[model samples]
Each structure stands twice: as C-alpha cells, then as structure tokens.
Target: MSTFGKLFRVTTFGESHCKGVGAIIDGAPPGMELTENDIQPQLTRRRPGQSKLTTPRDEKDKVTILSGTEYGITLGTPIGLQVPNLDQRPHDYGEMDIYPRPSHADWTYLQKYGLKASSGGGRASARETIGRVAGGAIAQKYLKLTNNVEIVAFVSSVGKVAMPFVHELEDEEPVSAEFYDMLNNISQEEVDKDITRCPHPETAEKMKETIMQKSAEKDSIGGTVTCVIRNCPVGLGEPCFDKLEAVMAHAMLSIPATKGFEFGSGFQGTKIPGHLHNDAFVRKEDGTLGTKTNNSGGVQGGITNGENIYFRVAFKPAATISKDQETASYDGAWGTLAAKGRHDPCVAPRAVPIVEAMAALVIMDSFLQQQARKASAALLPSVEIHHSLLGVPPKK
Candidate 1:
C-alpha cells in the first residue's frame, strides 16, 4: 500500500516525468488553518535547480491544494495537494525506457509489476516525494500547535567532507525564517563557500569545493543527515506492534537512494558496555525525570520519554550521473550506459528537508495516537482532574 499510519494516513501518487505528482492526506485534524503557502516553503527546499549540489532541473514545484481545505482552513478532511512537474525532459529519458539504469528500481519494478513505467523511473522517481513533502508540511504544523514538538534535520556528511562531530547538533527547534534564509542566501557562485550544508562556514566551503570537483568528473558521492526531535511528549507509540523506531526506520528508508538509517545508540551502542551505554535517569530542573545521556534516543519500550530523539540517515550518491557505466538493455543485451540528466552530484543538501518531512509525518501520527489515548482515558468516571492542570491527569 502507498498509504501509511493508522490515523493521519498519507497516500502519495504521480510519476517523475508525468504532468504532475501529488498526495492525498486522510485524517488531518479539521479546522486547522491551512493554505498552499504554508506547504510551499518545504517543497521549495526540496525542489531541483535551487543549488549547486543538486540537479539542475528547473522545476518550480508549485503546489496546489485541490481539496480538503476551505476558506484557508483544513476541513478536517482529506487534504489533496498537487505539484506540477515542470521542466520535465521526457526526451532525454526516451532511450532509457528500453534500458534499465543499474542500481535503480527499473528492473525491480519490472520484475514485481510485470512492466514498468518508462518516463524517468515512473513512480519510483524521487519526484514522487513532492507529495510526501506537501503532506508532511501539514503534519509538521499540527505537531507544533498540539505539542510544541519541533523537528530539524540537516546534511551532516557529503562523501569525504563529513561535518565534524554529529554530537555538536543539540536538540533544537525547527528552522526559523532566518535559518531558511541562511540556507538560500548563501551564494552558490561563491564556490569557496560552505559544503555539506553544515552551518559551520569553513566546512561548508570545503564541502562545496569537493562537490564541484566531483561533478566535473561526472561522478557522485554519498553522505548522511541527522534529524533531531525536541519536546516530544511521553506515550506516543504502540509497543509490540508498531514500535516508534520501527515505523521511523521504515519511513526513512522509503526515500529514494537512501542507503542506511540508525537512531540513538544504533550500531555505535555496541561499542560500549552497559555501564557506559546506559542512559541513567536523573531529576531535571524542570521537575521531570531526564536521562543523563541520550543513548536511548528519547524512546524506550516503543514510547517517547520526553527527551530528544535523534537519528542519522545515509544517502548513496545519486545513481544517475553523466559518468559512463556498464549495463544492459531491456533485451538483456550487454552495453554501457552514460546517464544524461540534470542530476545532483550530491543529494545531501536538498535531502535535509525531506528527512525532516518524513520525521514529522511519523511523529505526527504518533502524536495523534497519543491524543486519542488521552481522550479515551479521560472518559473514566473516577478520573480525577487537578484544578491547576490544563490536561487530564492520571487517576489518583
């Protein structure tokens, strides 16, 4: 199924070179103020031709809200959004219809579906994610209004030019207007400027130089993005069935060209013994129990523990490049193929927003689940409410 989540489900559609792509969001809370403008910024961040590190495909990625919204507010119904695929170069992909790109989903989709859509990987294209991003924008807004939860993700590694010390990224709020401006305002013409999308000036410059050199060689590189979730409340997961981490991993891996994913203490946790790796609980100044360390990544037993949750995602270099490579045609005849497309030599930069989008979708679904549980719990006859509290409290 192309849909995900029990509540707040999202269904994505459209193809890479098609007229347009879009998503249908079901279960969004009604009456929330929504508009095309609210979702456009996220799409703009993910669109092509916006920077030097990504493809030069000059897509406006302009989105339209077709349904589920009225009078600039969500009707609490399914939100249907569309992103027209401008700057599509179907002619460039004409020959590719018969020849599958190695390491792409072409051959796999053919094997699974008996035939494949020919234009630019059809449904498998990263273009399909425009819808996800649009839908995710709505989810992001809900998280902020309901829980003050904030999610942020950034490119931390680009091939050899990895950003220093992932630990340096503390749990922070989602990007503000200033942060977005900082990202876009940086001149790509300043070839000596930053790379890897790291906020640090020197490293960004090195990363940019490396990408330019590699793109000149018609090759590509891979890297990672780390996402942080802050102010996530407790009890936002379903244990033994759909664990939060399990769902999050699935969502992250669904993005095209994603190679690996790991959350707090992931593989690195194995390097230390329990004594060092364990997150010791401590009382915080806020009068809440907090972990001295976040080895658990803010989730324990498939539920949030009111701490920062973070994870890293690795993306392989864009497979479609100008570099010549060996492959076969649809007839299984051997041949060499050099891709022709306005492809990104490195995808890490644009992927930052996508990572945050997916994280928001996942967390938003969990947030809704948490709310439903609370609403259900409050119906009990003996439930005691504290006059000082704004929400339902545990039974006394």
Candidate 2:
C-alpha cells in the first residue's frame, strides 16, 4: 500500500516527470500551528542541484497547499500539498526508455508494471520524496509540541571520509545563527565537508577535493547517515507486531537508495559479550532507574526507555553515472548505455533531510501509539505500574 499510519495518515501521489508530485495528509490534529514556511526549508534541502557534489538539475521545489487549512493553522482535515515540476528533462531520458540503468528501478518497474516513465524514472525518482518530506515536517511539528522530542541527522560518511565520533547534538536547542555561520564559512566547494558534516576545515577540504575528482571521472559513491532522537517519552511503542524500530526500519528502507539500517548497538553488538553489551541499571538523582550505558539505544522490550535513541543508515551509491556500462535492453539485446543526466556523484549530503524526515515520522507514530495505549489502559478497571518504567503515575 502507498499509504501509512492509523491516526496521522499520509498518502503520496504523482510521478517524477509528471507535471508535479504531492501528498495528502489526513488525521492531523487541529489548532497545531503550521505554515508553508515551516515546510519550505526541508523541501529546499532535498531539492536538486543544491551543491556541486549533487545532481546539476535545478528545481525551485516550491510547495503549494490546496486544502486542510485556513490561514496558517491546520484544520484537522486532510491536508493537500503539491510541488510543481519546474525543471524537467524528458528528452534527456529518451535513451533510457530502451536501456535501463543498473541498480535503478528501470528494469524491475517495467517487469512489474509493463511500462515505465520515459523520463526521470517517474514514480521511482527521488523527486517523489517531496511529499514524504512535507508530510513529515507536519508530523515533526506535532511531535515537538506533544513530547518535546527532537530528531537530528547529518552526514556521517561519504565515500571514504568518515567522521570522528562525537556526542550527538541535542534537539531542544535551536540551531542558532552561529551554526549557520559555521556552515557558510566552510571553504570546500563540495558539500560532503568531511564524512560526518562535522565542519572540520582540513578534513572538509580533503573530502571536497576527493568528490570533485570522482565527479570528474564520471563515477558515483555512497555513504552512511546517523540519526539521533532525544527526549522521547517512555512507553512509546506496541510490541511484537509493531515494534518501534521495525516500523522505523520499514519507513527508512522505503527511501530510494537506502541499503541498510541498524538501531542501538546493531551489528556491532555481536562482537561484545553479554556483560559488555548490556545497559546497566543506575539510580538517577531523581531516584528513577536509568541505564548507565545506552547500549540498548533507548528502546527496551520494543518500548521507549526515555533515553536518547540513535541509529545508522547506509546509502548505496547513486546508480546513474556518466561512465559507459554494459546492460540488456527491454528486448533482451546486450548493449551499452552511458548515464546522461544531472546526477549526484554522491547522494549522502542530499539524503540527510530524507533520513531526518523518516526519523520524525517513526517517532511521531510511536508517540501517537503510546497515547492510544494509555487511553486504552485508562479505560480498564485495574492497572499495573512498573518501577522500571518512567513517566506517568503508579496505578491507583
């Protein structure tokens, strides 16, 4: 199904080469203040041609709201949003009609649908993510107001450049002008700016030089993104069927090029013994039990533990590159096709917003689920309280 969610529903539409693509969001709460301005920054971040390392395709990615609001606030109705296609190169993809790009959806799409968008991979294009990003921004606003939860994701790796380990940034703190100053002050022409977007000048310079050289050679590469969620309330998930992390992984894997995802210790935990990997219980100043180490990544028993949750997503290289390669056409004839389009040498930079959007969606969904569960529990005659869990009062 193209739709997601039980309470805050999101349904996406349109194709990459179509006039435009958009989404309709239903079940958004009323009176939660929102504006087109709030959604623009995210769309801009995902827009094409934002930097030298990304595709040269220029798109303004302007969003228009068609319904579900009067003035600026949402009406608690289905919200409709549209993004017009400003820069389309339909002719540029004519060759692709016969020869599909490797590692892309071209061949599989034709196999499944018997037809594919002649230009820009249509529905499969990363352009389709505009709806996701816009819808996610709304979810994020709601999540912030309800739980004060914050989600931040940045480039953690690009090609070979890996960022040194650093404490995750807090979400409650607003990114100040100083932060913008730091980003603007970066001297490298390429956007990777060190695998982690860490703003280390020397590393950024080398990272840029490397991407430029690769771009010039008509090759493409991929990397990883690490997302951190903070201040999320406890008891925010339904276990077994709808585990929080599983829902999150499903949403993330739906992205165009994501290849892998792991929460908490993930695969690295396998190397450590049970004692070393476990999160030890400790008494906080408030006398609440907390984990001294976050090896669990906040979620225990498929529920939030009121600790910072972090994970990593690995993105595969952009498949469309300038170099020639051998491939079979729709008629099963062996041939050569060189990618000819404005494409990114590395997609890691542009993917940051995409990752953040999915992360917000997961957290928001989990928070809503928590509310539903609490409401259901309140309806019961008796309840049980646990000393291990935070938030809420003991059952009376």
Candidate 3:
C-alpha cells in the first residue's frame, strides 16, 4: 500500500523517471503555518548531486504546495505536494530493458506485475523517498511545536569503517561516554559539516575516502545510519503487536536497499544476562520516572519512557554500478551488463535525512495514536483498583 500511518496517513505517488514525485498528507493539524519553504530544506538534503560521492542526477527537487493550505496556514485538509524531476534521462537505462540488474528489485517487480519501468528502478529508486521526506518535514514541525521533540540521524559507519562499539564481553560496561555525549548534543549542522554526514571528524574523512575509492572502481559500498529521537512523549506506542520498536523496524526497513534494523542494545543485549541488560528505573530532575541505563532504547514493553529513542538502520550498497558484470537476461541469456546510470557509491550520507524523516513519521503516528487513546480514555469515569490488582508498583 502507498499509504502509511493510522491518524496521519500519507500516500506517496510517482516513479523514478516520471514527470514528478510527491505525496498527499492527510490529518495534519489545522491552522498551523505550512508552506513549501518548511519542506524544501529536507528535500534539498536528500537530493542527489550534492557531492561527488552521490549520484549526479542534478534534480533541483523544488517542491510546490498544491493545496491544503491558504495564506500559508493548513486548513485541516489533505496536503498535496509535488517535486519536478528535471534531470531525468530515460535513455541511460536503455540497457536495463533486457537484463535486470543483480540484487535489485527489477526481477521481483517483473514477476509480481508482469511488467516493469523502462528507466531506472522506477518506484524502487531513492527518488521515491522524496515524498516521505516532505511528509516527515510537516510531522516533525508539529512534533517540535507541540512537544519539543528533536530527531537527529547521521552516518555511523561506511563499509567496515565504524565508530567504536562495546563488544559482547564488554557488555558489563555501558556504551562509551563519548557516544552518549554525541547523541545528547549532536545537531544537523554538525552532521552536514562533512559530506559523509558522520559527526566524528576522523571517521567522516575515512568514510569519504572509502566512497571515493569505490567510485573510482565503479563499485558501491553500504553502511549504517544511527538516529536518536529525544524528548519523545511517554506512552507513544502500543503494548502489543504494534510495539514502538516493531513499528520503527518496519518503517526503517521499508526504505530502499535497507537490510537490517536494530535499536538500543539490540543483538548485543543477547549476550548479557537479564540482570545486567535490564534498564533500571530511576527518578529524574523533572520528578518523572527515567532509566538508569538505556538498554531499552527509551522504549520498554512497547511504549516510550520519556527518554531518547535511538536506533540504527543498515542500507546495502547501491545495486546499479557502472562496472560490467556477468548476469542472465530476462530470457535466461547470459551476457555482460555494463550498467549506465548516475548512482551513489555510498548511500549512507544521503540516507541520513531519509532515516530522520522515517523516524519522524513513525514517532508522529505513534504520538497521535496514543493521544487519541488518551483523549477517549479521559472521557471515561475513573476506576478504583487495589494496588496489587493493578500489577504495577505503587507510585513513590
């Protein structure tokens, strides 16, 4: 389905080489200030040709607000946004008409629909995410205005070059103080300083070098993006099948070329026993409950705990490389395919905004869902129950 979210539904449309691409965003709060300017910054960040590491698609990605706003204020109706695809070159993908690119969506798309786009990856292209980034800009604005939520994502690793991490044997020790400090204070400006989008200076240089080497060889490399959501409202996710982390994983993995998702301790937690891994409850300066350790990633039992929600998303290398490869055609004929197209050697840098955008969408939807539940529950009369029957510890 093209739509996502229960309360804040978004339906994205258009293909890679289409006339344009955009999204229709429904359920945005009325009377809020909204304009193309609010959404353009993120789109510009996600656009290609920003650096030599990324594809040279040369899209301006200028967005236009078609409706759902009057005098720069949302009217509580569906918001229509569109971005023109100016630099499209369908001829570049002429070779793909016969042979499907390896490790790409080409074969599966053909099998599912019995037809496929003639140029580029069509819907599978990173260009498809333009709508997501646009919609997320609105949601992020609302979240910041209402709850002061802050979402930041940056390239944490490129290929084998990664920031330091605690090993299984070192699980007894918490994540490094430097790592925590970075999460607490990192900003988009700091992240964008380096083209790699890795806040750490040395690591960003190494990642840049790796990407340049891959581009020189007409190859591609993959990496991970780490995102942190701070000041998220408590009780933002369901306690069952729609656990906070579960939906987050679904959202992150939906991006093209994404292969893995993990939050908090994730797989590392498996090595530590329950006692050591459990996040102990503590009272904070705000007189609210908090966690002594954030092994739960600010979410426990499927709900936000008013702490920072952090996660990492892994994206595979760009499948369409300029190098020649041995592969079978649609008719099972063996041949050499020298893929011709503008493609990123390393997608992690470009993926930074996409990751933040998806995280905003997930958190925004969860926040609205919980708000609706609370509003309805508040209408009901209070019920008195025994402390033991409640199955929760008594308040201090």
Candidate 4:
C-alpha cells in the first residue's frame, strides 16, 4: 500500500516523528531536468502551519535529492528523496502510549502490527504524504512539459461552508469554452490566495472563520476538495477492471482523511435519465471528435476522451481533537482522553495539494501505460485490429 503507480511508479517511506520521510521514484526517463527546486514547492504547499486553520507544526519540510540526478538532470534510475523532521516533540504524545486517540489510526496500527510507534501515528501520519507530494511534483512537471496537462485541486468546502459552484453546466450542452479557459489555466497561486484556499474570496473568508472557530472550541469539521485534470490525452485506463475513474477513486480514497470520492456528475448524475446523463460526441474546432455534453466527466467507457477530467473528494475531520472523549484503550479500559497533538481543525485547505499530488500520480501512471500501449501497437499493422486495439489516435 505504501507504493503507488505503474511505470513511473513511486514508493514512499518513513514515519511522522521519524528522522525523515521521503519517496523513491522509479521508471522516470533519463536526461530530464530534475532537482530539489522542482520538488520543494509542493512540499511547502502541503506542510503544516501554512495558516492558523491547519496544525501549528511549523515544519519547513525542506527536501533533498539524494540520488537519481547528477548536474540537475535525471539519470533514468530510482530517485531517492528525503525531507527531515525539524520540529518533532514525541514526548508530548506520551499519554497515547497506552490509550489511542478516538477515531484515529492509533489503535488500528497497533492491532495490525501488535505494536505501534512511540509517538505520532507513524506511517499513518499526514507527514507520510510528504513523499507523495514530492514525487508527484516530478510527475506534474513531466505531464505538463510533455502533454500540457494541468492539474489543479482546491478547497471546495470547509465544515459547513462551501463556495458557489464554479460551473453549473446544463445537460443539453458540454462545458463552455469559457469554463475550459478558467478550469484549464487556473494557477495554484489563485487557490492559495486565501487562508482556507477555497478560491472564492467570500467563501474562503467564511471557511477560515469556521476553521478558527472550531479550533478555538477544540473541535474539528469535515469538507470537500474539487480537482480538475485538463488537457489529458484520450484512452487512459483498462476497460475491464482499472477504469479511469475507478483508479482515480482508488488513489483519492487512499489519502489519510479522505471519506468519499465522486467524479463528473457522480451521484447527482443518477437523478437524470440515460439520455440526459450521456455526453454526445461532436467535432471540436480542432477537428477532433469531442463531446457535446460532458456528463461523463472527461471519460467515456472507462477511457479519457481528451476533455477536462474533474472529481471531488470528501475528507473527514481530523480525528485527533483537543476535546475530551471517552473511548476504549488497547486493554479494553475505558476512560476520558483529550488527544494531545497538533492536528488540523479542518483538513480541506492543506489537503488541496495532496489531492493534486494523488491526481498527478494517477495521471502519470495512466500516461505511461498509454504510451507503452501505443508504442507496442506500432509494430502490428492489421488496420482493423489496430483501430480496435489502439482506440486513441496516435500522439502527433
């Protein structure tokens, strides 16, 4: 479970309060410009204490490129990356050596392993995602440079506060050119404009206030993040088992606090009939066959259709709250415990980058798989078989 992706695969290691945490990325092409500079930005974005709403851990999360590069270019080998833990206070969690936090992975980890870390959630900590963010940065750079793919995720809701829908497309028509413009070209700078990172200024303000209020009350809240993957090539996914959306959901739900995932019309699409839910094929201005409606998101029949792919992930509130709660200990002892640790009052804001990182991982793997399929199909020249097997047009 610690490893993710296939070809461009990533295996993340280390723990929350350990000396460091990082990832080893394999299958990257040689001679690509790579360095600490490319990875640090995403780590900083995912780090704690960026705002008062998040945990006040204050980790710099400075990453180091330990291997797989020389003179700032990749060597087509396994890349080893590390980020140190600068502000670890494991002693603060001594109370948890005996009693686990309610709703946290503490008990689960112990139950599975027969023992657990002395402090922090160990591998289950959000810090573990540091490696993912770093590795995903590489994937993002490659996808952007090669396919012009743009992946952006933002806080769509915090607690009960939510932004006004960015786009409310009708079933009769596809996403407008205006929406593609806004969604495709959106920058992380815009999403980070507010403390809550909700994109909508008014809603961001409300979300921040709600988070502050909850933190003050020693409570927490759950919310949602919306992500968009624009300018993706068509035909990325296995038709039978690894449907594009299914793999996407697998990736998103793997996140620590993620509770739910929905893409395209998702659950709401069920409200409409088959005709209305379907995305009709039409010709784009570029002469490529496209969808007149995009209720299928950007994928049809488990494959991408060269349109914007969008999804939403719901996050449960951080389980470690400062408020006291009664729960069972490892030995079946029941007592009141007020969790002692730094945790987000609402996870949506910091989770924005993680959502993007996970999305990048998925897209990167899909892109590589598609590339492999296309390359192998080139040697076989039966026209009918080629068309059937290589459903997507060859890369121009």
Counting clashing residue pairs in each candidate, in order, gives 6, 0, 0, 0
TM-score, prediction 4: 0.93
Give residue 225's lDDT in candidate 3 (0 to 100): 93
Those runs of model 1 whose alpha carbons end farther than 4 Å from true positions after fitting are 167-195, 383-396
| Deviation from native of the Cα of residue 200 in model 2, angstroms | 4.6
* Candidate 1, lDDT over the whole model: 0.80
Better-scoring candidate (TM-score), 2 or 3: 3
TM-score quality measure for candidate 3: 0.96
lDDT of 2 by residue, 1-396 (tens): 668776777888988789998999988888977888988988987888887767889999999989999889889899999999978878888779778899899988888988888888777788888998999899878887887777767665667776544223233222223333333233223333344353555655666676788799998888787777777888887889788888888988998888999887777666667877777889989887888777677798888898777778888988888898898987889999887888888777788778878888777777776788889978999655574574657666
Q: Please give the lDDT score for candidate 4.
A: 0.87
Q: Write down the lDDT of every candidate, Cα atoms only.
A: 0.80, 0.77, 0.90, 0.87
lDDT of 2: 0.77
lDDT of 1 by residue, 116-151 (tens): 877687887889888888888999898889888777
Candidate 3 — which pairs collide? none
Q: Tens digits of per-residue lDDT for model 3 on 1-396? A: 788888998899999999999999999989999989899999999999999889988999999999999999999999999999899899999889889999999999999999999899989998899999999999999999999999999998999898665223364654555666777899999999989998888888898899999999999999999999999999888878999999999899999999999898777778768988788889899887788878788998999988889988989999999999999998999999999989999899999999999899999999888888889989999999788896678888
Model 1 Cα RMSD, Å?
5.9
Question: What are the TM-scores, per candidate, against the unseen true structure?
Answer: 0.89, 0.88, 0.96, 0.93
Error of 2 at 332 (Å): 2.0
